[model samples]
Target chain A: MIKFSDKQLAIPKLMRPVYLVTAGQSKFDRAFPDKRTEELCIDALTQAAEMINVTPAELKSYIHTCYYGHFADHFGDQLLGEAVIHDRLGLDPLGNCGVKTGGATGGTTLWEGVKAVASGYSNCVLSMGWERMDEVPTDEGNFLISCAADKDWESPLGHIYTGYYAVMAQKYWKVFGKEEDSFRRTLAEIAVKHHGYARMNPYAQSPMKITIEDVLNSPVVAYPLRALDCCLMSVGAACAIICDEATAIKLTKNSPHKPLRIWVTAGSHTLRPADRRDMAIPLLPNETADQYKDLGKKFPGGERYPGFTGFLAARMAAYYAYNQVGIKDPTADLDVIELHDAFTISDVQTYEDIGIRPYGYGRDYVESGDCYHMNPKTGKPGKLPSNLSGGLIGCMHSVGATGIMQVFEIACHIWNRWAEIHGDDKLWKKFDRKKPADWTDLQVKGAKRALAISHAGVGSHVTATILMDPDKLIKKDA
Target chain B: MSMFGQVHVKNGQYKIKGDFHELTPNMPIRNSDDGWKLMGVTNPRDMTYIHSYGGESIFFESLSKGKLMATRCDNKKCESKGSIYQPFRIFCPDCLSKMTVIDMTDIAKKTAKIHTFMVCERSGAFNILKRPIKFINIEFDGVCTILMSYLAVGEPEIGMRVVPIFQKLDPTYTILDMAWVPEKTKSNHLPKGFSF
Candidate 1:
């Protein structure tokens, strides 16, 4: 009989025993006129390789397989994959395929990387998501997103993507008796915070500073959804490398000057078909609860859940991640969180859904400065600092690449390299740093554990990933 | 078993004796453009021109003394705004909007100021080869939008006000007959009784 220790059970090694050896990304923006999809992938891959002191050819030797996530305008599947392998990299991968799960593509891709290493099929794998949505005309681009929904019922009525979310916002208002300004104010705070953080990130798109007033007055894409409330459309690529423990240690020794080492603790996915599910009731509530229970069971006694959710699907995923990671008190245990803010309202609602704040108290979390940078005790600057990388709001949404971009920013924060270039501007004044000290110290101490959540609305696909510092692993590899 | 072939020539031409062949004459077939008529598609009905001795005017005096009109320009470039005839409206084909309109009598009498003018070298069904087609951008008195008309005359230039002349088609009606001429031309002036 096998007896599982709490520590050993908490962070399950990938069946293949994978480690995030290196991660890299290209700039996120509404469009990239000079760079194509393949170019962006190559640029990110090259940077990731260099960060770990390896060349593309060198990294290819360890890659047993590669999975890509791309959502281009047209003929993207056939052309983008081949273009990356043959034209850009000049090497044919042993195995290469693609996945599309709407906005959750990024999180799903990371989960795939985790699964690949854990399952032992490959000691090393490369996962990437890239999109170039801005190249197409706006009307035609919108048509592509509409294709993801139930065409028979939704498309015929001229139902726009924003309108779908607007209906949900309206329903939430009626059910919770929440004021419209409450949701709007929460969204504005989120956008302002993320935009503030985005000013620090070089790769973020639309890093301009925005205020709640700006969010309120912006043009309305849908009722109660001003322009600022909606995410921007952008072009970008994010990549991560997952390898086994032995390989990770070997690589680290080979290049001792590498960044932080984070491991995937838990991951869960839930698919809710729009036609079969109840739209009014929050989707995947049961599945999300189960995920949290499972994570808790894995990590017996933690202070908080350390879980966060940005969308309905993200809520379900966060449940599982929190369960596996054993987060007892999320507000105190978790160091940093990155969530999908496809719209402003999502941020407020996600706070409750992710179990971060109680159902009605999400607003208090925002106003109190507990989630953002203005916490008196933390003495940091910015809003919740949740979607600090401008999130999908300031960065805009590139369906396939949006989710992964959130993960990449979170990973950067955990790795502690996020603030290296973030302190040079007037934006840092928000931090109220009269005397400049190392920014990393301001990060939640003992914040070796972090959570990333992503989801898709059309089909309700949710994915969550928990990353932890490898030093905390209970059982050392023999 | 094997097969053998032999070649022979008769009357300075090679002929096959084993198998005889006959020649047939080819006939020429005529093709017509009648089946190619444009249909199911929208075209500029207000842009088609009517040629007459009245110097290429777009309107005519009806038997009832009211003005009748049609489009006059056949140029592909001018199709975007359709030819300005009676209703004298400036239409943009791209945006499909009426940019401006003016009275037909004012155009015929050359009471319009030339905003711009262009001389063309190409001629087809749309132009008379012997006579240069001078396209003028003319703005009538009291009208905001300008009209493009053909100038019959002395080298077309900006600021040139040309009047239109009409030829009587019957006792009570007239047809558009001829190009815009200098305002000073006696035949180009509007009749005393004409109101618009």
Candidate 2:
């Protein structure tokens, strides 16, 4: 059985290091129509084992904490779910429990794993997140997801997540949309780019490449939010094995798994969107009306209004994560990104929210094709290639699974440069556009720093994490 | 790569949105048996009510009688100075002082204007409403916080004065039984000096 024990590791200061030995995910596609939740859980777990050159059974003796993310306990037909899944995977002897926040469930679970390792709670923790959304019909699924909205205010009014975003899309168009329905064009363009990126990601759902023309013609689900502007309802799971420095060093010996020392440096979280005074102000609006008056005195901005729910939540997370990594500027300091694209408007707004661009300038950045991967030979791949694993849009959104999937893709891209398979020109030149490889441009351009941002929990919960390549961080220090 | 690296430690407090069932926007709420019926689906729901939510049963009772009620911090020492507003809460948000009820006897004549609004394709007692329901966030006279409701009438704009209209919903008459209408028209609940 996999085993390594030592004094608990301290974090951030790096007195004792913890590392992400490996990460994995099941096929991120709508292909698994009838898979059981346990089957999908196992599907992802076994793959995570394979990533580290071990079988699922070999992980039994060492797993200490089992953190699982499950957004739809109602849909899954099970309770005490983490216990049940851990039992099925034979990791039950360890303490296990589930944690969730509507959309940020996966990201939150990942943070739990980080705590387990950093807090000296566990040496090897299995962090998994999955959802069985494919079992339900589309309308029912939509309704179930709608339960994430404020049932009293948002749900009754049919201001479901899409509807919420659709209203934001309306305002965004009123502000930034280029021409007649230019906001629609921006969303169509984002869809085309992500679908194109998904083409190479083996685990992606709806990897079919589409043209802007096709996205433009698609039926609208919400005004301005066409069907393609949303994400896929895929049955998928993702897992990562985070271990302390002691276990990582031993495993890396004679193993293909490169220990990317737990380089994740920062994180942040906040409450529901409606708590904010106005939609435009990103963070919690303070709980009461009087508090907004105090907030106005404490943090002044002209005419605060709510724009999108998690803009400030995401901004705060990014701020904290950036601070952890000593990143001065996100657009310039970070190399790769995987952001939640619940809606194209959310994506465009996130560009400014996360400080990549100043507020109100997101439409310009998105329309410039700056988010797409530029060939390694041309502009710069590491110039912050985002959502390469197709993101929530092209990669498939299994709610709790999306955040972990983003982390998995970051690990994949970080290690892709060393994989040797894509080193050959013939195989590498297969696509002119950036596909799933460690796109040479990204690796060559360098810091190898990546950031993954997630927003969920009824449009308020958000988490931002910054990871550094152990080599890059070390080399720079030396 | 060397196996040595620093890991930092810090305790964190995460303020997540609390249980949302009760967090629905503070309103006099009542539910029906099946909400998903309008969505062309079978959803059997219970008649869940916040039950004089915020201990304001008297407030909802006032709405049916065409009276507007609010709460204010009664303590003179309290910084709020007895300013009144919808108390989906029991204590003062500013001073945490227990509040007393205030009846707006002229509630019927108080004018409210549309603040911001959205025309949702569906929203009603049941999830099945299909007629482009208009939900508006409105600012009422003498109220500090914005109130929300369906603008049962009018093409929406940022600032449009609208009058309040209430109808008795059978079985479970809640605040949702009231909606906003355009113009000052004759109504069963009409206040003094109100005319078309």
Q: Name the best candidate (by lDDT).
A: 2
Give the range of the ten consecutive residues with the poorest summed lDDT in model 2 chain A: A1-10
Which model scores highest in TM-score? 2
Candidate 2 lDDT, tens digit per residue, A295-385?
A: 3343232134443322666765665455445666776666778988887778887887677765556665566656767733455453567
Per-residue lDDT of model 1, residues B1-196, tens digit only: 3223334567966544332332344333223345544322211111212223232233333312443233333345543333443323234423445434333553445456654444533222222223334444455543323443455556665566676533343322321232456677654343333322
lDDT of 1 by residue, A184-300 (tens): 676677778776666655666766667789888887665556677777777778788778877776665655333334433223222211111112222232233334334323332
Please report the TM-score between candidate 2 and the true structure: 0.75
Model 2: CA > 4 A from native: A1-16, A31-33, A175-181, A261-302, A305-310, A375-382, A417-447, A474-478, B1-87, B90-116, B122-126, B139-148, B159-163, B169-176, B182-196
Tell me, by DockQ, which candidate is best: 2
- Tell me each candidate's TM-score: 0.59, 0.75
